[model samples]
Target: MKILLNKFLPKWMVLIIDQLIMSWSFALSFFVVRQFEFAEILRGHFLIYIGLFCIVSLITFYSMRVHTGLIRYSSIHDIYRIFSAVLICSVAYAAFVALWLAPVHNIDSVNIYLVLLLNFFIASTLLIMVRLGAKALFLYIRSGTAGSKERVLIYGADGYSILLKQALEASNSGYFSIIGFLDDDPHKIDKDIHQKRVYHVNDIENLQRKFNIDKLFVFNEDLKSEFRKKSIEKCVELGIKVLTVPPTEQWMSGNLSMKQIKNLKIEDLLQRPPIVIENKQVASDLAGKRVLITGGAGSIGSEIVRQVLSYNPELVVICDQAESPLHELQLEIKELFPDANVAVCICDVTNFNRMYSLFKDFTPEVVYHAAAYKHVPMMESNPCEAILTNVLGTKNLADLSLTFDVEKFVMISTDKAVNPTNIMGTSKRIAEIYIQSLNNISGKKINGNNPAGVAEPQTKFITTRFGNVLGSNGSVIPRFRSQIEKGGPVTVTHPEITRYFMTIPEAVQLVLEAGTMGKGGEIFIFDMGEPVKIVDLATKMIKLAGLVPNVDINVVFTGLRPGEKLYEELLNEKELTIPTHHSKIKISKVRNYDYEDVVNDIEELLKLNKNKEELRVVKKMKQIVPEYISNNSRFEQLDMHMN
Candidate 1:
């Protein structure tokens, strides 16, 4: 019966019902004026009077479309429509009686003006009350009456909070009930919104105790990072789930739904303030210039590509050996920036002839060399591949950049290169040394007396070194997420192991700023904020997934993998950093390397076949980087023998 009524009610029936109520209100007003004498209503042309009132009321209601709204979902706007219809009917009836009807019919039973006013008030009130009652009943029925609903406290007392509450009440999900609001604004504290008290954020514990708040909904787009982090931490500690709604603009058709709200993740808490860059300098360096980016499909390199495109580069050559990822990147670029001048090159950097052809063809003004094998354990086992890519590939790019007279070459290095204990880190350090030495020699040749057959050097090599990037491929965060999805033990290398972390975009922004700020031969080190312990990170991730750490999901400490370290360093013991204009960036000072000798040693190291004599390659690497020490691996024996 309820379904039939909800589905089959027509607009004309609503119009007829409103007219009948207004007629009844008119009759009741006469009865009240006549001192409860029901007979007095029938004394003087009462039937004609009621007929006139209905005619005027129907005209006004129809014109206003007051019957168009569904009663069960009526809003304040529907009330306004009802009021307008009543007021218009009252005015028309008063004018008809005073100017025309009284003289034509000689009817003087009661004051028509007072009767019309009374009808207006009674009719408008009844109409609004019916709609409100229906709306409330519908909400109650949709929200269900059986199970205990989870009480939710909204974190902001604003428009979004009100809308979220309305959405929750209207949804038939029967999962959540909004208790009240919590705001940081002092003036808003203790105030009432929608009959719910707004309390300060500090009152969360009291509210939780009183209302048993099972969740907190944060909808404030302008929330500060520190306060957000603190609130999330407090919520986690109290075992209350924290959720967030999408931004106001993202709401669908000015309506929010329960599906739009999502549980807050560990990433939200770990995010730092946005990095500010010297845009003018970066634009000046990149604008209208041809730029080449190796590993353009990978995380750091792809971010560099996206950021560089914003600077309006004349052409961007995306060079990566991976075909599928490069194709995906190309498709994304086409969708995002169809007019962007971009070309994809699927050639390995180590392919000297192909790279030479590319350089000769395009003659890039700047090159961002971000291609490297970064997985520690994988690179530990495949030392030869790591050296081939990180060392020889870098050398190939550097030599070609100089030969092609590229204006600037920005090489992406890592914190692992500092005080290296792993083959990957050592190879990167070797790349860094060779590039710095090449830059020094190029500068000397440019400044010195011109020798026969010697060309003026143009390429300036700059290296930007930072730590792990969040959300990068094969990073710990993704691994933890996968493990959590599988509902099993999350593996950590060591309980005490720690590493600095930064967002990929932030790291790339600093890289661009450092690249633009460099003159030549400078290694730029970024200030990666506090290092995070891997075990704590895993525990937090598990908890954020609504699972109890070590109970629902276990974090097992596997012994550190080969080439792994308990702590990572941004600078070697022998190198110190000098301040730069940007506080987050610094310039590293290290002993200069002899360019010819470093090049000859790298050539010798590359010539040794890993298939036949891998130890000889390791020994040669140790010879190049005197600080290279192997720990907890088979290569440690080589170190012992050398000692």
Candidate 2:
């Protein structure tokens, strides 16, 4: 049986089999009509009649290509093809008898016509039955030997869901046994589609109890709908694994494969509504302009590079200190946009001469500064490095943009920069101040603030601040996912600690929008919907992995790391945000700084950092940004002393 079902028969072989089946049908018809009188049937032109019928069947079936479809994978179209072929053969035979046989010989036309009609019915039925019977037999034997197939249920009862079901069954992977469909429509519920029952969405629990369902398949759009989101969550809570079907565009050759159906990830459920951007506005800003993206290989920066490249920029300079990642980004850009003119520069943003040469060479009209050491605890241990890169790197780009008369300088900031309790956040806050102050400096030489000999700086400095990006480098989501994959003891910083989460794409979209709308000296903050608890995130991640939270894998809550806060703030106590044209973005009403004072303080801080004065560097950072109070760190002592 396995050998027979292993591969499809050749078309010629299938044609022979079909003709033999039709001949058998003709013999059965004769037996029925003659009342088993074999002597009477053989006494006349029975041999010639059967020979003529076989020739007609062969011509009609071969012309219709009815044998082209695989018998084991037959569909409704195949059945229709077979039926049409048989009907045409029957009609042609009748025409032949009337035109040639009936006139030339004394024959009973009624009996011949009756036999032809019976042959048509018998042949059609037998052909369709043969294919269906083969399919059923194959499925039955395969199921019995291929282990117990997982009984699954599909979420939607629409045409897409039905097509998905057909695709899965026709693949012959022998893994899923679809029990029924769960639909929210009252008209579709309790109805049968393609021999599968459609149950109400509310009946998932009952269906689980009855059939012991192993998985629930859903379309991609269901994740965006509020009602469907809750339904999926309910299934997750009930411990049924949820699988999501990719969008139609992702299908291979317009057909869904078993590999295309992926397990739903926690990030999919946590995502907010789709962000709509002003495409024309962004295109106008970036089109045909030389754009530079610092740290272009990192998560946020890489997404920025991709989005900006789509705007048809004249040239894109992807600069980063990391050699391998920078090379990889260059390769990716070449693969994705073969016509795009992109340059890759491997140089530290902290080196003045290197950055100066970069600016002189590329001379980007728009600069997106994303280079910074962003980890909180890691920067807490090494404060000076944070200041040097985050503050100095930003200053280098901002000052160069002014000297080169760049149109805009957009700096990526963080929510932690608001009430900065860590060195990383404080350093970012200092960078923001320098950017804002430079934008506020009206037509001044900056008191001889190193190079950039200009009367009035033409650069529009902008800052975009947002919360933690989901799936970014060293983020909690990826960490939790890794821990769950290893099979035990997923660690959460604290049970009660919560942080605002946004997808990397979402953050980058808002940044581009903010950059487009910024005039200068304005700090833009994205609307992070709500704070998610660390423990809950861990639990959902474990559950998404098809494991129980506490039973299958233990979630251990370690104490918060140094300089980690229970909550991240987008706005400080003294600042307020006003709504912008885009709902997801707002401009912060932050205090303006004196350009001279900011320049003086930052220059001294850079000198201290250069001298490796870590303590002095951090102390000077606190003095520059008064909100730089440390939390749960050795630097917290410094905060207390200042108070």
Candidate 3:
């Protein structure tokens, strides 16, 4: 029977049914007026009046689309339509009787008005009630047929909360049943919303016990971070799955759905306030310029490429050695900006001739150098590759930028370069030093020499440094997520280890902003918020996955890998940062290097073969970066021997 009703009836059938109900209502109204005298209602003008009422009601109902809604899925809109149709029919009938019929037939006006009013009330009420009853019956059938429904509680009692409940109820899946609402507002506590009592957030445990809530849906916009964290923590402790709806703008066709509700992620919890960028400054610098981005297919590189498109660059040259990722980026750019001019260059940055040729062909006005070998442990084991890519690769781009007279060359450096502890860090530090010295030397030469005496280099070398980017290739977050999905122990290098984190987009935005602000020879450092402990992060991730840390999922502490530091530093002790126009960005003050000496040292360092004499290569690195200390690795012995 329910299945048959689920098959929606045709519009004509619904119209016919509604007309029949209106006719029955009119007859019932007459019987009530005439004290159940059926003979009088069947006589004279009564039959004609009933026929006219049916015709007018059918016309109004069809005009208002009152019969267009499915009885089993009727909503408030459908009810309003029904009311409109009945009210219009009643008004038309009263006007006819009062204006013509009552005076001509010598009938009482009050009696006629009363009969029409009663007819309108009965018709509207019965029509709405039948639809409501059918809707309830369908819901009951669905709830019973779909197996056991998970009892859930909403964490907010606001408008979004009500919408969420409606969406869940309307869902054909019938998996979730909303038990009640939980809010932080003291005044709202004990109040009823949408037929559900609103309980204080503190009463979650009690509510869970009473209602057996298996899930909690969070939809509050003004929820405090601390309170949110605590509430989620409590929910995890109670074994209640926490789900969240997307922002209202993301809703499909202004309607929410169960499919749109997703499990809260660790990234969502750890995310800080969004970093606002000075768009005008970035746009002014980049507009109409041909921008070249090295390693433009990697995580940070790709994001930079995407963001740079907004400034309307004359041509964007995406240069990367990785062929497949670069191809992927080219396709993405083509799809997103088919009209914009973009070029893809599969040139290795370490190959000087190739990069030189690239620079000559493109003649890019600005160069954003983001290519580097950044994995600490991997680079520690393969120090030769690290130097070849990170250090020499940067030098090739920097030298070519100067030679090509590019307006600005921005080098993307990392926090690990500050007071380095690994091969990767030291290599990046060396790169930073080379570019800064090159900037200073070039500026001095241009200022000191006559224009005819020497061809002046007019390039500004800018460096932007920040900490780890969330969800980057081979980052800890993805690794932890994969481990959780595999249902095993998530690996942590050290329990006490901590690192600063920022989203990839945020880091790239600041880089662009810093590029515009740089004059020459300045290393801009971003303000990375408080470092997060690895152990705490791992624990939270496990809990977010609905598993107890060390109980449901074991968190194993693997001893620190080679050259991996206990904590990463944003600035070396010797370096002091001066204020920038943006509070989140600062300019670092460091000791200047002689361009000649630094060039000689790097040339010699790059000369050694790492496979035959790895220690010799590492010793040269330490010499270049005196503060480079090897921790928990074979390179540590080199530091002791040097001392």
Top candidate when judged by TM-score against the true structure: 2
TM-score (all chains, Cα) for each model: 0.85, 0.89, 0.87
In candidate 3, what are the lDDT values of residues 1-643, reduced to their tens digit?
4464357779999899899989999988877887887777566477767877787787888888888776876777788888888888899888888888788887676766777889889988988888888789777777775447788888778887787788777765546777888888888999999899899888888887887778888753423366776776688678788887776667734546667877877776666667788898899899999999999999999999999998999999999989999988889998998888898989899998888778878899999999999999998898999999998899888887877788999999999999899999999999999998899776444333232243666899999999999999999999999998999799998989999998898899999999999998999999988999988888888877878888989999999999999999999988898998898999999999888889889888888843436899999999999999999888999999999
Off by over 4 Å in 1: 1-73, 81-123, 139-147, 157-175, 183-194, 198-211, 220-223, 443-454, 609-612
lDDT of 1 by residue, 1-643 (tens): 2353246248999999899889999988866666676667667677888888899989988998998877876777788888888998898888889777889887763477778878888888888987788777776664564356788888778887887777666555545777788888999999999988898888888887888778888763633467867876787767688887887778845446677878877667666878888999999999999999999999999999999999999999999999999999999999888889998999998888888888888889999999999988888888898888999899889887876778999999999998888989999999999999999866445332232223765789999999999999999999999999999699998989998999888899999999999988999999899999999889888877878889999989889899888999998888888999999999999999888888789888998833536788889999899888987667998888888
Q: Model 2's lDDT to the true fold?
A: 0.88
Q: Write down the TM-score for model 1.
A: 0.85
lDDT of 3: 0.85
- How far off is residue 516 in model 1, in Å? 1.3
What lDDT is reached at residue 343 by model 3? 89
Worst 10 residues of 1 by lDDT: 445-454
Candidate 3 collision pairs: none
lDDT of each: 0.85, 0.88, 0.85
Give the candidate order by descending TM-score: 2, 3, 1
The pairs that clash in candidate 2 are none
Scored against the true structure, residue 526 in model 2 reaches a CA lDDT of 92
Give me candidate 2's TM-score against the actual structure.
0.89
- Clash totals for all candidate models: 0, 0, 0
